[model samples]
Every structure is written in C-alpha cells, then in structure tokens.
Target: MKRFEDKRVLVTGGTRGVGAAIADAFAAEGAAVAVNGRSQQSVDRFLATRWGDFHGIPGAVGPRDACRAVVDAAVAALGGLDVLVANAGVFDELPFEQVTQEDFDRSMTVNLGGVFFCAQAALPALEESKGSIVATASDAGLISYAGAPAYSAAKGGVVSLVRSLAIGFAEVPVRVNCVCPGNVDTDMIREAGEASDDPAAYRAAAASRAPMRRMATPEEVAAAVLYLASDAAGFTTGVALPVDGGGVAGFD
Candidate 1:
C-alpha cells in the first residue's frame, strides 16, 4: 500500500478535483507531496486540515517561469522530485467552427502548454530520481467530442506530448504515461451540468452514454495514475491508460 514511501511527488493544480485526488493519494501512500495551485491562499485553505505528508506551492503551471518556480520550490521542500502528476487542465464546450482564438489558446495554454512547461521543469529532478511522469488527459483526446473542439485538441496534444516524453527520456530512466478519463463526478462535472441547465438529467444522460451506466470518481482516475507512476508500472511507459468506466473502450 505504501508503494510511494519516501518518494517526492508533485501534483499540479492540486487545489481541487482530480488534481486534489492525485495529491491526496500520493500523500496517503507516504510520498512527500507538493500540492501546486495558482494561489497560496487557496492552497492553504485546501490543506487546512489535510492529513499525511504534503506541502504547497502556489504557481500557475501555464506560465514557464511560474512552472519552474513551483517545481524549484517543490524540489527544495521535498529534497527531490520522484514523480509528477500533470493534472492541471481546463475544459470548455465550444463548436469547432465557432471556437474563438482566445478559447483555443486558453485551452492549449493551460492544458498542453502547461504540461510541457511543468514536465520540463520537473525533468531534471525526476531524471536524478529515475522517476515517472503521469499526465491527465481525457477520453475526448482519444475520440471526437462534438462540442469540445479546443478541449479535445488540447488533450490530444497532451497525449502526444506524453508519448514524446516517454521516448525522448527513455535513456534518462524517467517514464512518461497518460491517463485518459471520462465523466468523473467532480465540481468540473457539476459545472458542466449547470451549463446544460438540467443538472441531474444532464448527469444521468452522460452516465447512461457510458457502458457502465455511471461516471467514474476522481479517486478512480487518481488510482490509475498512481499505478502508472509506481514501480509496478516500470514497463508501462508511453501508454494512454483509460480510466473511464469503459467509456473509451468503444472508441474505434
């Protein structure tokens, strides 16, 4: 159960949702976790009563300088970086043709560009520790989502970036992989529900679309990421693991 004992892990955007779950999981397993968020106040509020071994570094991952600063502080706090969960991302529903440049850029900046910057910043310490990197992508990255062009494209780019890192860092002893999730019941999902105007009905409709007739939990996705980042997945680099209540299994 303590597979991550003594490891130093970083979870970007760890203030909420899947990122918070990933940070909590690592801390539960004895890793020294750095919960990275955009605001110190928010991070402090999140850790107000949190248990286990963890620290906080407030920095937006989308900016290169901020990513480096956060990584540096995390490494200094934990003494090194053993694993990274690139879980910071944004989702929006926009028609492909109508998606504005701002929308596309925002998605790419926070999702794809943030992954690149944060992962790059963590690489040196990870290389030294011979650690692993797990990216949080989406099933939309694997399949087309009718009204999520920017989000889908950004996630797809994340998948590609993870693969490239896996191959590029093969000789560095650092593994890279991605977890593609589907309809996790997080606040983000709630926001989507509100956007649809009928929360319960929208949630039900989304759940029914999946074979399992239910959405996954953030913990489920975090568990998948932990597995991929653990020693148990030593040979699992470059894979896009789907933790989606079988939602992605039907993709052609």
Candidate 2:
C-alpha cells in the first residue's frame, strides 16, 4: 500500500510554494489532504484543479482562533488529523536596525506563534492518532542572515519549540519535528533577493553562496517532510532535518 494511504494531512499556507508541494506529495501518496491559505479564493481555485480527496480551508494561521479553526475544519473534512505541516510563515528582508516592532511582531506571530498554537490545539487528536507534526523552519534558524534578523529569530523559536514538544510528548506517541530549509527558489526568497540594490547581482551571489551552487526546489524540501510524516521516519522525532545542501556544515 502507499505510505500515506488513507492518512489525513493538513498543510498550512499550501496555496503555493513549499506548502503546496507538501500537500501535493501527501495526496499523491493516497492521503486525504486539507490545503490551507489566507485566501479563500486561492484555496477554491487550487482545490478545483487538484486530484485526490482534498479540502480547502481558508484562514490565517497566526490568529489563535484561526489556528483552532483550521484544525477543526481539517477534522471535519477528513474525519481526523493524522499529520500537520506548519508551513505558514512570512519573510521580509530589512536591516536589523530598520526592523520595527510591528515587523518583529508580525514575523513572530506567523512564524513561531502559529506553529505553537496549531500544535497545541492539535495535540489531543494527535495523541489519539499517534500522529506527527512537521514545522517549516529555515537554515537561518540554525545560522545567521545579515538582512533577515527577525525572520531568523522567529524560525529559531520554531525549531526550539518543536523540539520541546517532541520530548514532552514522547510518551504520548505524538512525534514533533522540524525541517530547516536553505535558500529555496520560492517567491519569498526570490523577492527578498530582488529587493536588494542590485537585484540581478544579489540573486547570483545568493545562489553561489550555497555549497550545492544552487538553491533547492520546494518539491525537494517537501519530500523530506513527507518522509518525516510517514512511517519512514517512525524513529525520528525532536530533530531538525536540514534541507540546506550543507549550508550549515561550517556554521556550527
């Protein structure tokens, strides 16, 4: 049978990019997936074109009520939640000194806070199902980025928080882990790179900085998450899997 056959999966911010890739991967594995995004219209459009028994739930994961609502919607649609991929986050490129309190709050709310709330609300069902949770962290959480301090710090919190959950829930049979991806060719990274004074040069420099000599694709990172969510990673928990192409090898 397929690995995720009959599994019910929910992927936040799955309207595009990495989240979308993950949602698709699970569905391809025979999962009943719920795709979440801030835009109901986008969610509708996505569901209309996608195969498998997929549901579209629209809401921002940052808000506490919204977080609970997404879980509820997923359970309502798929009967129960077996896996949750917390892929909703914001990324902005600005100097540390230029980052306002508003910027910091927004970053934390979506990146770190959303993960915490979603996992917390999903814990009971997860415990019942012995399910898995995968949070989307960034290589920035393991290293440092010059222009994205807030983003880095928020992602770092994600890694730490999920690790704690892993240990706390060890006996509960709910596995919690994280995926720290490097520069992926998503619109987020592309826009950040292009925001520099020399957009073209910035993209080239960023691309060359990685040891692999190029950024990763969303599909590549999604595969790692899928593995963790499936029985393939049954023994894995509380670990931050780096899809960075050795970007953090020298940093630590």
Candidate 3:
C-alpha cells in the first residue's frame, strides 16, 4: 500500500508552485487531497487535471473566515483530515528603508497570520485524528535576506509560531513543523527575476548564490513536506527543517 493510503489532506495555495507540488505528492501517495486556491477558476483548473484524489477548495487564506471555511470544506469533502499543509504565502522584495506599513502588514497577515489561523481552523480535526501540520516557511526565516525585510520578518514569525503551536498542542499531541526552502525555481521566483533590469542575469545570480549552485525544484521541497506529514516523522515535532541546498549553513 502507498505510504499515505487512506489519508486525507488539505493544502492551502495548492493551485501552484510549492503547494501544488506538495498536493501532488500527497495524492500520489494515496491521500484524498483538497487543493485550496484564492479563486475557483484556479482551483477548477487544478481539479480538471484529475490528479489523484483531489477536491477544489477556493478561498483566500488571509482572512479568518476564509481559513475556517477552507478547513470546513476540506473536512466535509474528504470525510476527515489527516494532515494540514499551511502553504499559502506571498513574497516580495522591499528594502528596510522603503518598507511601508502597508507592505509589512500585508506580508505578516498572509505569511504568518495565514499559517496561524489555518492551523487553528484545522485544530479540532487534527486533534481528533492526532494528525500533523507542516507549514512552508523560507530560508529567509532562518536567516536574513537582502531587500526583503518584511518577507524575512514574516517567515521568521512562522518558524517561531510553529514552535509555539507544537508546545500548545502537546497535550493533544498533534505535531507541528515547518519547511524552510531556499531559492526555489517557481513562478514566484521567476517573476521576481523578471522584475529586474536583466531577468537572465538576475536568475543566474540567484542560482549562483546557492551553495548547491542551483535553485531547488518545487518537488524537492514537497518531498520534505511529505516526510514531515508522514508517520515516518512521528517523533518529529516543532522542527524547522531546511530544504535550502546548504545556503543557510554560513556566510560561505
């Protein structure tokens, strides 16, 4: 039998990028997966692919109501919840000097607050099943990144939040963890590069900065999520696993 046989999962931001890959991984492993996106259109497109056992759940994770709605829909559709992947997030570069209050609040609301409320919304079901939560943080959370102070701060909050949740849920014993990926090759990253004067050069520089000499594929990051959500990691909780190709090791 597949590792995730008979499991039910909900992945926020699952319509694209790292979330999409994580959703695919869960489905492939025999889980009934719910894919949440901001729009019904994007969710429908993903569901139309008929990839594994998937249901479309359309909602933005930024709002408290939407977070609860997504979880409620997932539970209704999938019968029960075995794992919650709080993967919805946005990214942008803004130097500390130029960072507006609006930009900072937006980043925190989506990146950190989204994860927090999503997990809270899924808490009852997870407690019932004693399941786990795996959030997508970033290497920026673990260390500093140039030109993305708001983004960095938001992710750093995610790491801390995961730890706190793990402790909070210890009585019920629901595990909470996060994955921190570095320089992933996704549409989000591509868009960032395109915003530069020379997209090609921008992309090249990003790849070169990684000690591994290449950006991580979304699949690679998904693999980490898979492990965290799996029974194989039953003993693991409150850990921030890095999938960053050694980029967080040191200055060198």
Candidate 4:
C-alpha cells in the first residue's frame, strides 16, 4: 500500500514550485489532499489538471484569522487532517541596505508568521489525528546569505519555530518539523535570475555556488517534506532537515 493511503493532507501555497510538488506527491501516495492558494482562481488552476479531485482551500495565509480559516475549511472538507504542510512563503532577496520596512514585514509575516499560525490553527486536528506538520523553510535560515537579510531572518525563525512547536505538541501526538532548501529550480528562482541583467549568468552563478554544483529540483524538496510527514519519520520532531544540495554544509 502507498504510505499515505487514505490519509488527508493540506498544503498551503500549493499552486506552484515546491508547494505544488509536495501536494502532488501526497496525492500520488493516495492521500486526499487539500490545496491552498492565495485565491480561488489560483487554486482552481492548480487543480485544473492532475489534482482535479483534490479539495481546494483557497485563502491568504499569514495572520492568525486567515490561517484558522484555511485549517477549518480543510478539516471541514477532508473530515480530518493527517498532515499539514506549511509551505506558503515569500522570497524577497534584498540587500540589508535596500530592504524597506514593508519588505521586511512581508517576509516576516508570510514566511515566519504564516508557518507559526498555520501550525497553531492545525494543531488540534493534528493532535486528534496523530498527524504531523512539515514546513518549508530555507537553507538561508541556517547559513548566512548576504543578499536576503530579511528573508533569512524570517526563515531562521521558522527553523526555531519548528523546534519549539515540536516540544509544545509533545504532550499530544502531533509532530512538527521543517525542510530547508536552497536554490531550488522553481519559478521563484527563475524570476530572480531573469530579473538580473544577465539571466544565464545569474543561473550559472547560483548553480555553481552550491556544493553539489546544481540547484535542487522542486521534486527533491517535496521528497524531503513527504518523508517528514510520513510514518517513516514518526519518531522525528523538532528537526530542520536540509534538502539544499549541500549548500547548508558550508563553503568549499
């Protein structure tokens, strides 16, 4: 049998990139997945194809109210929840000097606050179902990334959040963990490259910077998320697993 057969899952930011891959992976493993995008239109588009039968829990997830709404909607649709993937986040790569208050807040709210509130909202369901949570953090949270100071701080909060939540939920059966990926080959990365004057050079430099000499695929990140959410990782909690192609290991 598939690992997640008959399980129920909710994936925030399920419209694209690593989020989409993680959603698809859960569905493929026989979970009744709930996909959450910022809007219904984006959710519909994501489910317009392979995820046609999956539930769409569309809503913006940053603050407490919105996260509660998404979790409530997903639980209502799925009857219960076996896993909650807090994968929704923003990537604003700005130098420390260039980052404005708005930019800093955006990263903190969406990247760190969303993960915190989403898990808080989902905790009861997870406890009842003896389920788990997998959040998408960043290797930037672990290592110093000079270009994205605010983003790094936000994700660093996530790394810490996972650890704290794991302990908080230990009285119950809920488990919490996070995956930290670096330089994923997703639209986010592509757009960052294309925004540069030399897109190819930008991509090349990103690839070369990783110790593995290539950016990780979304599917690779998805695999790490799935492992953490599955029963295979039942004993694991408060962990920050890096799926960063050795980027978190250290410089060459």
Winner by TM-score between candidate 3 and candidate 1: 3
Q: Model 4's lDDT to the true fold? A: 0.90
Index of the highest-lDDT prediction = 3
Candidate 4 stretches greater than 4 Å from native: none
Per-model TM against the reference: 0.96, 0.97, 0.97, 0.97
Model 2 over residues 20-110: C-alpha lDDT tens digits? 9999999988999999998899899888888778899999998788899988988888899899999999998779999999999999999
RMSD to true structure for each model, in Å: 1.4, 1.4, 1.0, 1.1
lDDT of 3 at 25: 94
Question: How far does residue 8 in candidate 2 sit from its true spot (Å)?
Answer: 0.4
TM-score of 4: 0.97
As a TM-score, model 2 comes out at 0.97
| Ranking according to lDDT, highest score first | 3, 4, 2, 1
Model 1 TM-score is 0.96
* Clashes, model 4: 0
Off by over 4 Å in 1: none
Candidate 1 collision pairs: none
Give the per-residue lDDT of model 1 (tens digit) for 25-74. 88888899999988989799888969778898998888788788988999
